[model samples]
Target: MDVVAFKQFINDQIQLFAEKLGDAKHSSNDGVSLGKLTFYLAVRQSIDKKASEQDMGLVGAFNDTLQALGMVEPGKTFMSKLDT
Candidate 1:
């Protein structure tokens, strides 16, 4: 499939899976959606994997620092200057 088709397919699958999970299983009671949590976890896992492969702790540390500073939030890819 083309890149666009593949992306759409992935989106459709995630939507279907989310719908199957519904509100109860799809999200925690903290109001964070499962999609957001999943995205954050995926990013963390990728960072960890890269660090492990490269034998560098700085990558993970950088991720942690970003999280601690609230520069990276679940499901948020960019911090808009206009938001504040």
Candidate 2:
């Protein structure tokens, strides 16, 4: 999928997650937590109305950060430099 489509997907997921979590970022009120992408809290947190922007920034940043540390490779990570 392209970035546009990818952002739509993430945004949709975020909306669903937000709804399930009651939009609770930090609290003990009661919720299912971050759900599937709990491991990607920061990434999930970075998500916003501007999903396309955030998505592209994150993917590029991840790629560069890993490359700088000599860890770039095809299908190396769940979130690679995916086009979308």
The prediction achieving the highest TM-score against the true structure is 2
lDDT of 1 at 43: 38
| Candidate 2 per-residue C-alpha lDDT over 9-50 given as tens digits, one digit per residue, 9 for 90 to 100 | 766766666666665554463345554344233454444333
Count of clashes in candidate 2? 0
CA lDDT of every candidate: 0.47, 0.55
Give the TM-score of each candidate.
0.30, 0.38
In candidate 2, which residue pairs get closer than 3 Å at backbone N, Cα or C atoms, i.e. clash?
Answer: none
Give me the displacement of residue 35 in model 2, in angstroms.
4.4
Location of the lowest summed lDDT over 10 successive residues in candidate 2: 35-44
Whole-model lDDT, candidate 1?
0.47
lDDT for 76 (candidate 2): 67
Clashing pairs in 1: none
